[model samples]
Target: MSLRDRVISTSVESSADPVELLSLKNPVHFLALGFGSGLAPKAPGTFGTLAALPLVWLLIQPGLWFYLCLTLIACLAGAWICGHAARDMGVHDHAAIVWDEVAGMLLTMFAVPLNWSTLLVGFVLFRLLDILKPWPISYLDKHVHGGVGIMADDILAGILACVGMHLLLEMGWLT
Candidate 1:
């Protein structure tokens, strides 16, 4: 049955071991769960973003166009990846479904030099915007629904963080 056709379950909300039901072997789940990083008991988003760092480092190696292209591809595919996992879990935007975080991290690092300083700053900014949910970010988070909804706020957060990172770099603050 389609997700809309069935009643959403409270199991995700009530169960203590929601991760157990999901398999890492499933490609969609693997991606949606941030390559198993989302399985973290607490602060799954943080863990998920952390998991993206190495990937981001490697992604940036191919130059700006390559990084941008891959990031775009990831963003496009994220909706289906996250949505499918959410459907299987009978939840919308489950905590363990952190593909959004991965995409957000990629966005956060956009056009920025990858280094310890930039990585640390980008990580903080993305997490803060994501956690705080200020203004339109909060609006998108609340108003949007489904996988796109799940991704929208983080996307904006990443963009904002990217802007912030650029500002810092331009001002010689991040260097």
Candidate 2:
């Protein structure tokens, strides 16, 4: 089959098995929240971000540098993995591939304290920036393609979210 056909076929749903949904052996499966968020007919990205929260919370306590490093790794790896998966499935940046969200949230919380308010703000900001895709992010999203294209905009959004979160924290606005 052609590459595009493969991508489209990979995204097709036949069953609702949770195990099958979460399996990432195929890069696409690994990315689409194991297909969990992908299965959602509405707001899959939001669900994907929410699904990543627990992991992001756990990673945040290791220190800002560690989280930043992890986020970077995820972004880099996600580009490859998500891209491969998308190609395998005959698609581009599938909704089920939420590793981008995980990486983005990690970026958002990089320097922020681990608290509900901070987490909430980071979540809102990251999601808003990701969805809005402003400035360089929007530019990158339009101009870039492939694995880098899949992951670039979200990474930029994460950076923006991190900046916004830090500002809010510094100003004591979140407390």
Candidate 3:
């Protein structure tokens, strides 16, 4: 269903806590919650980003085409996963729904050489951009709606981080 339809069709009381509604058994929720990493009581997004490390390691192994294709698939599919989970929880971009972070981290590390320093830099950069939400990123977060809305800001943050990583590489600041 469209985000507008879901919003109009459901009424979540302000007093009602939506976290209780999340069920990991539900595959949609499982993926949306970053394989349960998003369930962390504090900084779920951080934890969710951390959970992406293994994925980053794995994606970096194959050539760029494979990595890019898989990451693209995740980003596209994540939109549906996140939107469906939000609809189920009756919340918009709930903290527990962090598949966007997973996708963001994937994008952040794209094509960057796998190493401790690069990994750390990408992580910090993506997280900072995601949290600070500057300019166009902030604009997309506030203005966009539905699955696209939930994923747009993070995607941009990931792209920006990816660019930063490339810059660091080209500048010989990181190797």
Candidate 4:
């Protein structure tokens, strides 16, 4: 096979132990791996999102503009982070590269009231939207490629979750 073909087909061998990822020596891999939350044997996405919660709570305390600028930075930089990490792992969008979820959750909680109720509701909504991959989110997940592709679906899911969450609050449905 050609070098290009070989590179394109590169992916994590099934026999490799998932926990070995925790030994990643690279910084980008560490961040893209969601600080090891993606190392979880199951539901690593959920764990990655959960790991982002405390971070959001702390960061959002400053105000919306600060939170937004930071989230944008994270999202933009995360594309690179995830891309390099995936390449290192020899996989495309490995289950472990969940920094996308961090950016997604940040977007989901953006401008929303920082209360337990809103946080809980938004968390559920984000996970549901991400898992379900409704509409354009699903389209992006299927059609897009590379690190941008990995992050795009979660970003769309985050936008949807943000819209759903804000509606819930505005309508006084969840408070």
- Say which candidate scores most in lDDT: 3
| Model 3 misplaced regions, further than 4 Å | 1-16
lDDT of 2 by residue, 1-175 (tens): 8755643554465433323323555545656453356556677778777776787877767777777777777888888776765566555676766667777887788767787887887889999999988899899889988878878888899889989887887888985
Measured by TM-score, how close is model 4 to the native structure? 0.88
lDDT for 99 in candidate 1 is 92
TM-score of each: 0.92, 0.81, 0.91, 0.88
Compared with the true structure, what per-residue lDDT tens digits does model 4 show for residues 81-155? 887776666667888889999999999999888888888988899999999988999999999888888889999
Worst 10 residues of 3 by lDDT: 6-15
Which of the numbered candidates is closest to the native, going by highest TM-score? Answer: 1
By TM-score, is 1 or 4 better? 1
Q: Which model, 2 or 3, shows the larger lDDT? A: 3
Error of 1 at 19 (Å): 3.0
Would you list the clashing residue pairs of candidate 1?
none
**Residue pairs with backbone overlap in model 3:** none
**lDDT computed for candidate 2:** 0.73
- Candidate 4 or 2, higher lDDT: 4
